[model samples]
Target: MTPHEIGTTFYAYTAASSSVAHILDASKPATFSMVNAHKRLAILIHGFTSSHEDSHLQSIKTNMLHHSNGEVGTVIVVDWRHGASALALPPYLRAASNTQVVGHQVAHLVEELRKHHGVNPHNVYIVGHSLGAQSAGFAGRYALSTFHWKLGRITALDAAAPSFENHPGTFLTKNDAVFVDAIHTSASKDHNPLNGVFGFVHAFAHLDFYPNDGHNQPKCHNPLEIACHHEAALLYYDASLSAHNSCKFYGFSCHDWATFHAHHCTKHDAEMGYFADKIHASGVRFLATTEKYPFCH
Candidate 1:
């Protein structure tokens, strides 16, 4: 699908001034007069059938604003709703095909930010969920191949498994960024119907976190527990953004939950979400959370 047909839009926000926000028009890029070049730039991308206004994205935006604390930072929320909302038969498949267009567009935006606003590509942090996560990989790859830009970090929240699971060069991978991390909360084991899930059960990042066994999340009693499980990834991430360490999730390196529960993986190897240790955190990791909100233990 073409970009014009997809109709992507960008919304820029600076914590310092609500009045200085950038809006709907694609022709007018956000002016970073208040934001300095070296400051962190966060780009939050929502999944298929989701928009920039999704609660998960908004939570991160709010949390980022709090973390930056009126500092010189920019949080740009991408909305490709038109592309994500295809109404034809097999709509999800159609939406899945449009992710590449969105990714290239994001790369273009990053190039502009670096060229015109003095923003550093290495300072950019990409946050995306499901299909959005897949797009983030594409964005990272496009930036590197087309513009020679290596993004600093990319966090995939339970990256969608349907269209991307085993597809080479079509899914999120560790090579997408300098430090790519993934939080798998609702991973599926399609091999057994009883253990079906929504996310890929494979390790797709330099650091992969499978919280609560990566499926059957606690406190999920919905009729479709799978959905509740799928959503827990973002919520867990959102809670980890709190100022208080009580909610900040610290994970341990382990082969699996059984190994983690065996009391072998005791030391906290890395913190999840915003505070992730880009230095030491690598390979497969596991963590536990409460059955309710403020899940971190």
Candidate 2:
């Protein structure tokens, strides 16, 4: 879809079974008033060729709601599938172009929420995967530039690498939000042509968590693992929000994977996933995980 033809839709999901409301226009006051933000609000964005109804998004939504313990006021799913649809232009190019448009729309929505609904910007969190992750950064950047509003946090799940790697300021960065955390999975070292490419290898966020060296997730060696490792980042985040918060994906501060593997790094400060705390220190963090389900210990 072309930039002019982009259609950005918002769906609000709350505890009420009938709370699924479609926001036709984000710029209007009516749309903001419709949202019931009694607690924190989470805006979930999907990647290219994905939608609000995708299984991965649904799973993340379910986990967020289930673990919030009624503290989550609402979950807004940003559906920009039209803009992300495959077109004659390269898929990555299409996504890159759409990011600005969709980001503006999302920023407007947040502005409206703060202005009309009295929703605090600090109570808003954005979680996006793959190309959507880059779009989230754009949204945060727009919010700060246009409204001077800093988002609470932004969690990037294996942000897309192609067309974004080395393109500083084009994709997600620590400056996008007050606290930006990135989970790097399926990242290709040196742009390895043999490995399946999905996520960026460079550390872009304040807290960059690398699980299993950030590549070739166990049990995902086959061709069907298109987004297997990338998607695992979401699952890992979900696990962090498990009931009672039993799982903790502890991360150790490290300058590089080589030093981390060599046991040279000793400071373990950052915790990967939902319950992650905001730390002043910034650097690459390494953490190990199990190959089976309940990967986090």
Candidate 3:
């Protein structure tokens, strides 16, 4: 078996003190030589209060290192300059309130990647979760309009519906990527219909919904449930493996938290780790197929 190779690139940014809006970041082009050369390039943005190595992106990076056929690729982790110094949850909430700034940072990074590495626009992919997802969408929009940088695909994993819905350009209708797919965890009971995200739901080239509330993903400490949702996302993403089909939606069910909490299911951090990995694997499969590969080569 080939050993997996992985590397990280950091981006620096300056934003208004009041909001984390990206002002300027120009050093991204210098970091491409540090990336692994065996897989498709992946740009992973961490959510607010999270590190560049957050579990969401790290797990996927691990998977790609091992699974990518002899061609390793770059994984750029965009660290919010002040994000590391702030409290995790609270700042995430505050920062998420305005995601366009982060998106601007992503747009800058993408341009640098193109100019420095000469990466084909169609070979790059963006992956994000929650606020990060919103950032990915924002970046995709900016890239399209400014550079006409078409992407192979963009995947938003269980993104918070706030920026996704309320913002016009975040969804496909506003500035659709060459390919866009979203997986919103059904774990939230408060999916306000009045919110723009609900309306934006229909714009994804492909969309997936879990049966549980936004917080109730598999491994709400239940291995069985985790396996199920993992399988569901895997299958849903796999449907596009042939590259001939357009995007679609998959609605899956995991144990609802209301029931889990009501029944007092034993909560284990270990179990949560399991499910997170499963979900990440599902994401990896989706990403692998979206690029130009030997199968499509």
Candidate 4:
């Protein structure tokens, strides 16, 4: 389908979900008031076969607002399900190809967020998962080249491995934002065949994290459980946003899991995931997680 036919839509939510119920019309200054435009805004984009209503994105959306208290003003979920639905034949590839078009739509939406609503580029954060993460990269590229505006942050949760390995232009990268970070849950360096990699193997962001050594997670032992392991990144990130969460989301900056496991690279200052305290972070890090939910333990 063409980019225009994709009919990408944006839904905004505040602390009180029922209060402000207008679709984001960037042209209208009044639309800004509905979402308390002055505070920090987050835009979430889901991966293939998912929509704004999907639990994958909604969990984070629901948690962020509840956990952050009133600190975060608005959470916008981008609905490009028309381009990401299962009905699209050749499923994965079709959704993958549409990422570029959806990215263009996001780029325009992001530009309007500032121009019409008086929101600064620095106050915005774009978070995406899998194919959606790659699309977020495209948005960052378009925003920079077209508008010369740099976004504050972009968090890529396990960017899709297929269709984006060797193509720098089609995947999430550090250049996409001032602070671009990614979590690798189902893929690791070298991506050995026996490991069953699903997430993109490359460290494509400023802070690339390898949880559970970036291989199959605790319960995702079955080789064919691609979807299970891939969603681990999303699960870990959402848990980090919990208001009562302790400081258990930390990792050591190391060369690889070997270095971290061997008891070297002992410094574990920066908390990984949603509230990663260290912003000037560079290079990959390693951390351990449990086999079950509330994985931070």
TM-score of each: 0.91, 0.90, 0.57, 0.91
**Cα RMSDs of all predictions?**
2.5, 2.4, 13.5, 2.5
Question: In terms of TM-score, how similar is model 2 to the real structure?
Answer: 0.90
Better of 1 and 2 by TM-score: 1
CA lDDT of every candidate: 0.79, 0.79, 0.44, 0.79
> Best by TM-score, which number?
1
Candidate 1: give its CA RMSD in angstroms. Answer: 2.5
lDDT of 1 by residue, 70-125 (tens): 43277888999888884754777887888898988888888877777788888888
What is candidate 4's local distance difference test score? 0.79
Residue pairs clashing in model 2 are none
Q: What is the lDDT of residue 217 in candidate 1?
A: 82
Worst 10 residues of 4 by lDDT: 188-197
Candidate 1 or 3, higher TM-score?
1
